[model samples]
Target: MKEKVLILNIGRCAWGRCIFCGYSRENYPEPNLLRMKVDLDRKLVGFEGDTLKIFGSGSFLDDKQFPREFRRYLVEKCKKKGIKHLTIESRPEFITEDTLLDFDGIDLTVAIGLEVADNDILKKLGKGMTVEDYTRAADIIHSKGFKVRTYLLVNPPFVDDIKESLDRSVSFALQHSDSIVLINLLPHANAPLFDLWVEGKWKPLTREKFFEITRPYANNPKIELDVETFRFVPRFPPEKRANLEGVSSEILNHPHFRVWQEYLCDWYEKPKDKTIALFLPCSAKKPYSKSKTHTLIYKTIKTLPIFKNIHRLVISTPGVVPFEFNDFYPFNAYEWDERLETPEIKKEYIKVTKKRIFDYLKHHKYDHYFCFFKYSAESYIALQEACNELGVSCTNCLSRETYEALKEEKGNPLFKEEALKELREVLSKVKQKGT
Candidate 1:
């Protein structure tokens, strides 16, 4: 990206868990901030950007997470680099005058998570701070000649409907902050929302519903809603996350897929040929084709040309997505936590998934239905059970016919071993670099 953005993840977020965020557990973990600084120093060898963003999980002002000496060094480093705008993610409580004073000359901006103005939602998300506290912090930052950016969630837990919450979140944010970032929920781990999902309390917001709710604020320039969050996944394993501040050309240049625009409604184009239906769960990476899970599945079924032109759909939080739409905005751009895979949660997902899958099946006529997905396909199991209840047949990898047909005529017998070899090689390279 010409913008020269430096997205850094220092360590775990200081305030512990935010019910909605998995940054602490998913990204950096309880990392040695000192070692993180050293690694960052190594990666910044050729950073020639004028704009700087210090976005590790913790509050930049938190002395414990980011030592005073290290913070001072970063400030001096940015100053020496001639940085124009400097921004960091922190809590409203940490927006002290003393901290703002550190960015006296640089264009400073403090981004905070004021998920919504509603007191109930704040309490539910475990945001110990309140909306009033955020406003005061924003005012303090503004007084210091700096900017304040606020983040709000789209579909939070306990909200029966997403439109009401989106409107409420946008209305309050537009009035109190310089910019607003609308974050869509990517529930996983023991995320409070995901907990609700397990009990059939909360449903993933459809793209149409999400856009319809946020349409009133669409024209507002200060409001920035990056649609990629719908399918955003945080894959930071060494080989996936490079030395480029965890940034890459594909990541930087990935298209911003919008689900809902007041002016455009034709986001999903249907497949005319209903040949054979094949469903799979989304992987932790974008472009599902590149994911190891998908690689294995494809290799297992490639010999059967008869399944070609099958209607391939990836069942995700956004609902059923055709393979043609896999690379689009919400297809693979989501970041869900890994801890949310309990047996209880799968039951809830299956119950809801069956409804969407049935709705999809009504329009498309397929000679046969098949599924081949990893454990990620919790909903697929539900789909099978749902079909059974309705006395409809859905073939899966475990099915006798499907298993018999799994061996591809030209497939490599040692594909799994080869894949593991590549994995070890990458791990060794990372280990050597750390030394």
Candidate 2:
């Protein structure tokens, strides 16, 4: 049995001149590429257990010269080969009744890159369509009985109201589509917008800010949100690095630390109390075995006299001990075994982790549980469910996956320079505020 994957670079974009897009910038041999892809499809046709899938970079339906022929070829081949699924990407302007007709009787899903719902930001990004365009396109796709997926870009550069923009975007997608794929903007070397970013004219939201904007949509059942990391280069100056170096130390001396200390005086912090405890995960444990932030938090909590009178808890995987904090609840790492090498073991580990958290929360209650660790779909789902069961408020930090993606994309020499400068400015502010 053999499986075949075919990606067609069908030329032409519906919204060809989008400022932030560069999909159509690449050169392509349309007919030749289609022939090559078809030949590949034929090669896999003989295999009894084979599957075939077709997709393209630009708007698949907008390439009028070749897309129709390719679609026909693909549908016929798929029908003959009993293919599992066929997928494609397009813009709102390209999705219409005629476009949907092309996929008739084919097991296909169409995805549109609806970057955002804010018209002003869309214009800023040079997107060629409006929210109305996406809504209409969604209706057309749904009417034709095809599953529709939308691509959403969060915290785009130069967006002043990042939170409001994301909120509106999520609301629009939830109202119109079945599933949403959320991605952070990753500027590439050849991308048109790279120059703007490199010049410090554009910037992605900070990690903390990203989480604050997306927290509301984290647990929505109607929409399936998948986060894709941006790819960028890292470029930070020496001064910026120096400023960020001692942030944790300075935070330890802040008033927030004082408030945390007062709550720690009490064994249990209640939900009705003014102070709320945040549970964070610590994965790094070696030598003395302590989380840098956890240690800093403990020190800060100790300084806060009000912490003794409020509710507090540290939900963590067993690794490091919290310093003299009796309110800490240590949950053994469900997947601690380095020897568990199989997929089944990993699945069991996740199941065990979910069960442990659920079981523990069933008996205990908290006022607010803020997750200040790497954001993961599984962790977010589990924590949300736990919070729901306890009837308490729960929130998670920004998706680390998104941050990593942006870092990879922004790491280029051009964007990196600007990021370095911003980091330096932020650090300077932090130092000034600290003093």
> TM-score: which candidate is best?
1
lDDT of each: 0.61, 0.53
Candidate 2, residue 434: how far the Cα is off, in Å: 39
Worst lDDT run of 10 residues, candidate 2, spans: 240-249
Q: Model 2: per-residue lDDT, tens digit, 90-194?
A: 777778898778678775677787888878878877887888888888889889888777878876776777667777887788778777876666554345565
The alpha-carbon lDDT assigned to residue 412 of candidate 2 equals: 28
Q: Residue-pair clashes per candidate, as listed?
A: 9, 30
Q: Write the per-residue lDDT of candidate 1 for residues 1-435, one digit (tens) a residue.
A: 123455566665678667766566555544465776676677667877777776766588777677667767777777887777777888887889887777777888889888878888788788788989999998899998899888888777756556777787777877778899876666543355544443456645556666766777778889877543533332223332222112222222222211111011222335555466677776667777788766765665554444354666777554566776566544455554335455654565566567656666654556666665432356666677656766667755443332334334354222344433432232222221112
- Give the per-residue Cα lDDT of candidate 2 at 135: 89
Alpha-carbon error at 208 in model 1, in Å?
Answer: 2.8
TM-score of 1: 0.59
Looking at candidate 1, what is the lDDT of residue 43? Answer: 62
